[model samples]
Target: MAAPYRSREGLSTRPGAYGGSSDEIQLRIDPMHGDFDEEVSGLRKQVRKLRDVAQEIETEAKFQNDFLNQLMEKVLMPTALRNELPD
Candidate 1:
């Protein structure tokens, strides 16, 4: 299961990519929308923003985990127990 994508408009939208399988559910899109290009531009911008946000989150999580591990080893570990951890 994947997380639902959220757009800048705060609307939760299914991903724009389509599965080629014939059994997949088809969604109805508004064909009469004023400008298709504008819609695509908006979606592109939202996707970029989401990608950047996800990357930032991943980097931050890694940094925090590494920091916590170092902090624990240096401050929480007893001298006798330090050797128990793998180098």
Candidate 2:
């Protein structure tokens, strides 16, 4: 990427915006680092909770399907045989 404007002149020896000269630039820490970690941790917790709920729903569905199959075998099979056996 190109800069907004190219500087033909080299480094200049002048006073900086702060108390020091331009050669000595100050390093600063970003303020959002802690907030970023907190947000990630919260998101992880929500994902874990969602996974647990999905597993529970899957287990309940399997159980209900098995119960329905058993009920059909016990209740409907005899009725179907009786209908075919007589008027």
By lDDT, the best candidate is: 1
Off by over 4 Å in 1: 1-29, 79-87
**Candidate 2 worst ten-residue window by lDDT:** 3-12
Error of 1 at 38 (Å): 0.7
Clashes per prediction? 0, 0
Error of 1 at 19 (Å): 17
> Which number leads on TM-score?
1
lDDT of 1 by residue, 1-87 (tens): 232443333344343458543332222346674456776787678679989999999999999999999988877668657778688
RMSD of each: 7.1, 20.4
What is the lDDT of every predicted structure here?
0.64, 0.61
lDDT of 2 by residue, 30-74 (tens): 565445565457557766997999999999999999999999999
Q: What ranges in model 2 sit over 4 Å off? A: 1-34
